[model samples]
Target: MISKRHADILKILDSSGTVTVAELANLLGVSTETVRRDLRPLVEDGAVHRMHGAVSLTGPTAEAPFRRRMRENAPAKQAIAARVAATILDGQTVMLDTGTTTSFIARALTGHRRLRVVTNSMDVARTLAVTGGNRVFLTAGEVRPDSGAALGPAAVAHVLQFRADVAVISAGGVDALAVTDYDPDEAEFARALLTCAPRRVVATDATKFGRRGLVAVVGFDGMDELVTDAAPPAVIASAMAAGGARLVLAG
Candidate 1:
């Protein structure tokens, strides 16, 4: 029941996480007004969400499903997680948000002992809870089936109650300007987690470079470290320098 234009729009959004009205029009070879018209029914059908001036598969389908996302860039994510895990000391309280990369990070923490792991991700909670020496806390909130993440006001409030030594997060995009997310509520939830933690780390792969999202979780300055499989583009280097963020490239 989807039109060709709608199908193409969804395809682009799936690959890049977000696309603006003007950008879509140019890519589709249609007028801006025409592209807007095409987006109306798609948005109504719960196929996508419109935010600010762009459209993305947000809300329930913020990125991709858990199992599918776990396979996407699996190797890169594991490397990033391993590098992130290496920086953590035993007995440290670490916080993480819901995302496949963070799930990998949780798996990487299994070897550490007596650590407290707090997360809004059901998968992350389950992964670490069964580990022999780690204590896991799953926050109270509405769990979105699509992402298996606890988000919204209640989750943010719950995160405020716990202060962490480090917070590991993932993003739809790590733009030259800021770290962004396609879901607004998730972005706010991440912002709350960042504020509650003394050190904040962002885990993402190289594909996120130059991508766009509906909302920015934080500016570059808010990130204490960025762990990825490859080095960032030259454009981000200036921002990292100005923000005092250390870039850690994993193997």
Candidate 2:
């Protein structure tokens, strides 16, 4: 049987994706040694993965589900979202792809007015459609149960039909070479969004820095800007500079 403490730890991991040992110890009102003891069984069961001083649901290769991803690095995501939203004009047309960060961007945009939003994310559509007198176009295609994102060729075709002022996308991982995603269909969809707009922005938290992803969405040359809560590592920063992409750090 899972102990109450173990269950609580799982809950925190489920929501936060990763937490430091010190933070967990503080939250649990226990010593670091006690937290380590509780984590051992969970790690053995493959319920969580341990790092040097922290724990996460698993390695970056396995993408977390949408709800969990939304909760993960939430404050940083919100800050990035706000920063991106501020750069957008009140009445500009925007193309957005499906991802947790982009969902936060949609929410941050609720205060703006007369915006035309194009997206494959049901979460983005529902958030922006009723507020701000925005016209939201939800792409048509098969929806993924985990993300509620429309995917496949039909969705790509739907996105290509509109021209927008800006395109904002979230990535699963971002290495020096490219912005990437775990799902091939979503990566293809993001590529389409990039083409539909002149200004292409990638919104991701710092956790994605230097992480490897399964599918390449776009090379840095194809990106206009990167919005995040922290500075990227040297390799990534150099790549962004070489590609002429601006890196905006959010508070």
Candidate 3:
């Protein structure tokens, strides 16, 4: 489904055939950033082709980046973290992927002790380290400077060697029916973790609602549960259900 802003912009263009980002932003009383962001999904969806600062949707649609596309949805992220934390069993081995949403899980896990954490996330490992009283194993791999997470052939291999009771993976995007990521290595790492671990969970905010991008990380069919802020829209809810995921609505 097209975003409200995207739809509105498209409506205005039916009469003129095209509009610039600046004009759309000014007309909509929103930032150019917002306008550009709205256009990106259309470009990815092939609904509209973006030319310079302008966009036009003719047919179909492309995927949008979930994690990076929507960074400001803090409330949804926190709620998802709370739900993810609630799923942990005492002393259960858990693996968390590298993402801001997963970091919130680390914070929520502060009170838990003696839990085994297998992770490639420097921030997550550091958080557990300072918290004290946890059996955390840092994965051996190359760290991606931007995400501050370890990933590589070694990381994938290392993650695959372990078996955990639970694993929480995050992503950069999702479509009407698939889960995906923008970084190929991150996708590979997450998939490897899911493969080795038994019970799998996905943590994502609402902004990841409806889009697919880059590469497929894990299909919806693979997740045992999906922890999100609330019951998402009809499309998202249906997709997760179709995959047989126990949808956990947090907060």
Candidate 4:
């Protein structure tokens, strides 16, 4: 038998499809930490899916729903974003990939003095577009409504025009062999960015470790840097050593 709190959580997730940790905490008259603890079992039981700071009834799939992903592990993502933003030089061109972590990076880049950003994420483009001293370019392609990302042959072509100083992308997983993505089109776009930039940087949280997606975007051997909230597993560490990729831990 489940606890009343667990039952309530399931009820909420079922009705709304998704809810944030803070929202659940508030509604349940508990602390955020408590809500997190409450969610672990449900997640293990496959009764709930935990995104950054949010929860949903659906289990982990090829792609997490966008809103839930944005709220999932938000603080860790922010930390990773700030680290990614700090390394970018002023007035340099950057290729931004589509993902919640990259969206946070876009927000972090708002204070940068000058930059040229080419991206397929509508969320990323919108976040930095209005910021002063920044030039934002949005790719043309079919937009995934939930993710707000443009991905297709047209988008890949648009991204290929710029030879960026850095390519900051997000990954569904960073395992021993490759960096992967849930969507094939998104993976293709990411690979295009990787080829166009000398510095290939992947920004993702620790939760992404060991999780593989439907397609591989780039192999571990091709990565230049990885920014994350925790130290990678031994397999990843070994791969990084063999590939000469630098790992940046945000915390």
Q: Which candidate tops TM-score?
A: 1
Error of 2 at 147 (Å): 0.7
Question: For this target, which candidate reaches the highest lDDT against the unseen true structure?
Answer: 2
Cα RMSD to the true fold for all candidates: 3.8, 7.3, 9.6, 8.3
**lDDT (C-alpha) at residue 218 in model 2:** 92
lDDT of 4 by residue, 41-133 (tens): 988988786755556776554245677678778999999999999998789998998998999999999988678999999999999888868
Off by over 4 Å in 2: 1-64
Candidate 4 local lDDT, residue 80: 98
Better of 1 and 4 by TM-score: 1
lDDT of 2 by residue, 1-251 (tens): 33999999988877666566767888899998999999999899888877546677754554555666787789999999999999999999999899989999999999999999999999999999999889999999899876799999999999999999999999878899999776789999999999989999999999989766678999989989999999999999999999999999998
Query: What value of lDDT does candidate 3 attain over all alpha carbons?
Result: 0.75
- For residue 161, model 3's alpha carbon misses the true position, in angstroms, by 1.0
Off by over 4 Å in 1: 1-36, 39-64
lDDT of each: 0.86, 0.89, 0.75, 0.85
How far residue 193's Cα lies from its native spot in candidate 2, in Å, is 0.4
Per-residue lDDT, model 3, residue 147, is 57
Candidate 1 lDDT, 86-165, residue by residue in tens? 99999999999988899999899888888898899999989888876889889989999767899989999999999899
Q: What is the TM-score of each candidate against the true structure?
A: 0.82, 0.78, 0.72, 0.76
Which runs in model 3 stand beyond 4 Å of their true positions?
1-71
Q: Which residue runs of candidate 4 sit more than 4 Å off their true CA positions?
A: 1-64
How displaced is residue 105 in candidate 1, in Å?
0.8
